[model samples]
Target: MNRRGFLMTASAAAAGFALAQAPGAAFAAPVRKALPRLKTQQVGSGDINFGYHSAGPEEGRPVVLLHDFGYDIHSFTEVIPLLAEQGFRVLVPYMRGHGSTRFKDKSIARSAQPEALGADTLTVIDSLHHPEAVVAGFGQGAVAARAFAQLKPTRCKGIVAVDGLWRPVPERAALQKDRRGFARKLWTANSPDWRFDEAVFARAAVSFDNPDFAAILTDTPSNAAVPTVSAPVLTLRGSASGIPVDDPTARMIEGAGHNLPLEAPQAFADAIAEMVRNAKWRT
Candidate 1:
């Protein structure tokens, strides 16, 4: 056979082999099973019943997702299917104090320490029976992912942080001054209709009740621990207004600051697909 013909045959053979090994193809070969709907699953040290939503085959490669505070798993609604379409099983859990995840004892305060959240995540993984899985987080969710990866380096297959606001979040006392400044800026930026009750803002702020949350927000600007993650870390930051500077991983995106899934879901989904593919390649 001519050299060119031989090369073409080899390439075709390789492609065929790859297709058979692919999760999508593998599932197609077998009898199809019904995929489950979004449901509550009890996981982690807190034994919290977390609301989980997923796409793609359960037997496919696992990619665990965590979302920012004040947002539910729905924050990732736009990105999960893309990952699944790429042949990855996406797992998103409601973090402690958010959505369906509640403290074991409602009376006991849930501390937002990286270690605590990390431990809880580990517990969830154990409960799910996945020996190893990729972990990714968005916004404040990135902090929990970083902590989880740091604590369970062996178990964490890969890590991705998107538009993390790890920068200094001012304490309430310090925020007093900024509040006035922000109020003045708001006054100039919009009409009186924009004015909202201070009580509404206060309730929103209290959700991040743990002292560590405040400490990290305030110190995140200089904090580099997030980049120290031993697992492959993919950091993404949006470019538009309100993008925070505290992202710890390598910044990978721009043009849609802060709210990546909302402002630019396609870009966000692509970033996650790349991270999962790269992570699988590395492993």
Candidate 2:
């Protein structure tokens, strides 16, 4: 079957969800307190210390959520609770060089190359003792998700790629000049439909302060050889993005841009839930 056949054009209705909260609305204190608190933890993997946030029942089916470049785990803030409530074990890891994740050895290369990021996903899953998981991500996180699927197909029940899957190109020299400005520009350019305030942007932007952020952002040879994915895949794109609609699976998310998790949390979470329900591994 064609790979594009995996694409399911998701909407709130089709995914069995309703947009109860206003877009970008802050959750009420009582509602927030009602949800399971995200447990922050770290695991030593290779030369990197991987930090991740997890929630939901311990025995719940595992689902790993990866955030895009220029953003951190908070990118999935809205989506996390939605999935957790549905009894999915949600794990959101800070990619290497982001958040509390750091290189253990000072001399170790700080590279966010797709292969390295993909390997980290597997490590996070293994460290957490999950047999397998539904891997989903946005932007560069999408790339990592795809890579993980290729690397260890059996471990990934399915993958939901939001916006687009991007291949990184090293531009460290130029990016180094104005990292924050670069990220700000990405937010404006990628999600033209979403009007995020300074506070929202600041929440994720602070992650760029990691010492190795620049190296990882700009470090690359663009030469991670990955095998063809044998696992089921779902591809989603924002109506506002430049991603082509040629593929059969290319479903455009109305009113969303490249940042689907933040701009359209309900739809994003719904996609993952859909994948979980349909996954062959689900017991």
The top-ranked prediction according to TM-score is: 2
Best by lDDT: 2
lDDT of 2 by residue, 25-63 (tens): 221112211222245788865778888898887878888
Model 2: CA > 4 A from native:
1-39, 167-171, 221-227, 242-246
Q: Model 2 reaches what TM-score against the true structure?
A: 0.81
Q: What is the TM-score of each candidate against the true structure?
A: 0.63, 0.81
Task: Give lDDT: candidate 1, residue 211.
Answer: 29
How much is 151 displaced in model 2, in angstroms?
1.1
Clashing pairs in 2: none
What local distance difference test score does each model get?
0.52, 0.69
lDDT of 1 by residue, 163-205 (tens): 4433333233432334333222222121111222333223323
